[model samples]
Target: MTLATLALTWRHLPAAPPCPRPRVRTSEAVLLSVATLALLLGISQTTTWGWVDPRTLGLFAVGGLAMAGWVWLTLRHDEPLIDLRSAFRGAAAAPNITALLAGAGMYMGLTLLMVLVQVDTPSGWGLGQPVAVAGLMLVPYSAMSVLGSRISLWVGARISPGRVLPIGCALYLASTVQLALGHDHVWQALLSMALAGLGSGSTFATLPVLLVRAVPAGETSSALAFNQVLRYIGFSVGSAVGVTVLGLVSGPVPDEHGFVAAMAVNAGVWVLAIGVVVRAIAAR
Candidate 1:
């Protein structure tokens, strides 16, 4: 699937506009890389290392300080890796937040679903699906996401992009709710996955449009790049949160209650994303 998508994107790619490459800021890049690595490591090890462990705390502190320094350096430099100011304002901020939230919600959901399906049924929670069946169940989600993207494009032609964000968020919110309450049956699970795909596809389709509308033509690439960064950050944070939530309820393996609780929490993330996008629009 990945290879096919890559081939398709490569085939339809547009000719590049003539633009000089931006000069590298080695110091800023190095500092930011350190922060990202440390933060990711700290988060990943929270379960294994124990959250209160000095090593974990130290890594987080170092990462935070390095991130702060990197931000300061970028604002001070004339030719920084990215123009942070423009990217963090107006229409860009909402979609970026949405990207982050979407990242978090999507990853959390994927992890939850994978666990919910495969754990032993005797645990009173999982469906006890074989690994292949579990993978097959996700096919609807992948297919629906593509359809949802096209649907977003169609909807975008008729409505404001701001409207699209909420619509997308709402779909995922509904999906999460469905899974939280009605996931006893495979059909229900499939429906939740479909809603998730639609919701995600809507946001994914609209984000680039919002980003382009927010920035000048020259800064578009940088703005999108920054947005991508936020999405990855969201993914890391979501993975951490999912692990933490499940850990709190785990015994031998996570209980069914943990899966339900995690889905509920992720649903809240969707709500927060909706609020952020709405507030950003209001701020404009």
Candidate 2:
């Protein structure tokens, strides 16, 4: 199926016209890479190194300084790696911000759900399911996300493309709330995944469109790439935070309360994304 899809895409998709290659901003790229790596390391290792440990704090400080340097160099350079100024203006800014929040929320929910499923039933709220069963649970989410993508396109054509993001965020929010309130039953988890998939598809699909429309043709690739970077950072942060919260609440084995707390945080993130999306639309 994957091969066939790839073949079809290769055969049908139009080749992009060649454009002049921009000069590589080596320093900016290095700084950004250093910052991303340091921050992610610090976040992911919090459980092991402890938050206030010098190693963790050192990583955070390095990441922050690198990020600051990247911004400063970017602002001064005529042809920087990414056009931060243009990317943060108007509609473009909305999708980037939404991507960060939504990405974090989505990842947090997914990580928590996986852990919740595999947890031993003796924990009172756990399902004690095997890894295979837990993996199968994501099938609905994967299938529904494709359907949601198509649905968003249909809805966008009929109404406004801008509205699709908020709608998607609402669905994601609903799924998080559902998970927070109940997950004792397998059916409930499946339902939540389905809803989350739809929301993810809708928002993910719409973000690119909004971004493309907002940026100049020449900067499309860079803008999209930057948005993806933000999304990934959000994902890393979300997963780390979710695990941290669960660990903090309950030692090695997380309980119902821990799961609930993580989901609640995820839900709040989605709410914030929705508000940002709505505000962006209103501003326009």
Q: Judging by TM-score against the true structure, name the best candidate.
A: 2
- For candidate 1, lDDT tens digit of each residue in 1-284? 99999999899988688889788889998988898888888977887887889999999999999999999999998878878877666667788878989889887887788777777756577777899978976788888889888999888889888888888889989998988998777788888889988888887888888898888887888788878878887887787787678768765577768777888889999999999988887777
Q: What is the TM-score of candidate 2?
A: 0.92
Quantify all predictions' global Cα lDDT against the true fold. 0.84, 0.90
lDDT of 2 at 272: 96
Q: All candidates: CA RMSD in angstroms?
A: 2.6, 2.2
Candidate 1 Cα misplacement greater than 4 A, ranges: 1-21, 121-123, 250-252
lDDT of 2 by residue, 55-143 (tens): 99999999999999999999998778899998888779999999999889989999999998888846577888899999998999999
Worst lDDT run of 10 residues, candidate 1, spans 117-126
**Model 2 pairs in collision:** none
Give one clash count per candidate, in the order shown: 0, 0
